[model samples]
Target: MSKKEVETTGHSWDGIEELNNPLPRWWLLVWYACILWGIAYTVAMPAWPGIKSATAGVLGWSTRAEVAEKIASFEEMNAAVNAELAAADVTMIKPGSDVHSYGVNMGAAVFRANCSQCHGSGAAGNFGYPNLLDNDWLWGGTIDEVAYTIQHGVRNETDEARYSEMPKFGADELLTDEEIDQAVAFAMSLSDPEGDGTNLVGGTYDVELAAAGAEVFEYNCASCHGEDGTGDIYQGAPDLTDAIWLYGGDHDTVYDTVFNARFGVMPAWGQRLTQAEVNAAALYVHQLGGGQ
Candidate 1:
């Protein structure tokens, strides 16, 4: 437009007039549309905050409610199968059956969510955690036993929890350092009768120490660990005769175990997971070739 037609805001900077140029009509219309949409959105969905909670919008729509609806639908779909699983005896759930298939898949899901933190994703286990795929069970390996352990857990506050405590022979002064040394030597020798008192990782000890340790083990550890060092499942004592060491079978590790003792805790899944979930987890673990 010509300078004569242009209206100025009655201000000048260095003799340049300040033109009162309004924004584009379309731009102003879009801006007004955005403000209206925002107000509508606030009214139609959960938005404004209050003292105790957010305001429930006019539409009463919420993300949490949507999630709850989805969960309810899924639970309704699986209710029948889950009820059957919860009621069924885990031992009698034969392989390749419908319930067995459901249980295995469900158990795998449960194990991934609950057990995989300590036990590996593949149930291989970590240091101080028992491997679920192995036959070397500190507790019994039966399906029923696995279910019970999952329900009550080990070393937990639950009254029915599996409980056991090994003496800190060296740390507590229940045994002399020499006696502990002997006991460690004997424990190592249990797994390797022909070799010198060697740990699983090839750390060596005096085989001579084992002979004296035999008496020490018999007098002190035999009651819980068994006379032959095979371990007692009732007491949750680990088998010294096996290469499957939860806390490592190395010489120093063995000495540490003998000195301070090892105490590993598994959570009572029954308190967390549903009964059907616990049952499925037990069933899946039982058929993994480790269960007795």
Candidate 2:
């Protein structure tokens, strides 16, 4: 028997003839399989967009529900520890105790989630933010103090917030430009014992200008900053004696602070976080080696 000849397409290019060929059975089967799979997938999972939300598939699974369930599990696991932290007195929790350790761990998480945005991941602080790892606290560094500050915040709008207003000597016309310069010199002298008013390099003190500036400081700044420039924590006056500065410690920076003043604000965590979270954050900060 002779084999049947395949027919050529009606159109041809040059001398070449084209044959219309059917798709491979295997290829067609695969294409059909894909279509069926897509239909099944649409039925089994959320695939269509709706006016308010996505379509609820037969499986009824939701990413939000999954996240909620995980959060529930985490809360369940930490319920007892969180309860203890909420109830325990922040001052009485000794450093090496289990509760203290737990607070430190949990507080670290809280700090990362919330405080890290301002204080940095390691709490080293940015230019305006205060460092947490050091012994220089604008407010008192005691555990109770730390807790109180965290709860009520500093310069926040809350009634119980730690509030202080640094008078802008230049802007407010409280001090002449020359007097402000003298005040800056005196403030610098407090931190730099050997610094002369002429140069910041540590050396023999500039007795003459320092003496002059001291009078200026005593007359204007001593009310809140203390006669010795040790700063009154109760008044939120930053200690000038320490070289550590929330703003820069350089002469220009000091002049700006004296002239314009600084009023940094911290939000009241008590309004945002639960009592246990607040206590944990306080404990974590207190244990960071700066707490008094």
Model 2 TM: 0.86
lDDT tens readout by residue for model 2, 1-292 = 9987778777789988898677799999999999999999999999899999888899998999999999999999989988989998998898889889989998999999989999999899899998998887877899989999999999988999999999999999999987887777777788765554433333223455566788899888999989988898889988878766778777778788988999899999999999999999999988888858
TM-score, candidate number 1: 0.87
Candidate 1 local lDDT, 11-114, one digit each (tens): 99899999888989999999999999999999988899999999889999888989999999999999999999999988888989999999999999998988
| Reference-based TM-score of each model | 0.87, 0.86
In candidate 1, how many Å is residue 201 off? 3.0
lDDT of 1: 0.88
Q: Give the alpha-carbon lDDT of every model.
A: 0.88, 0.85
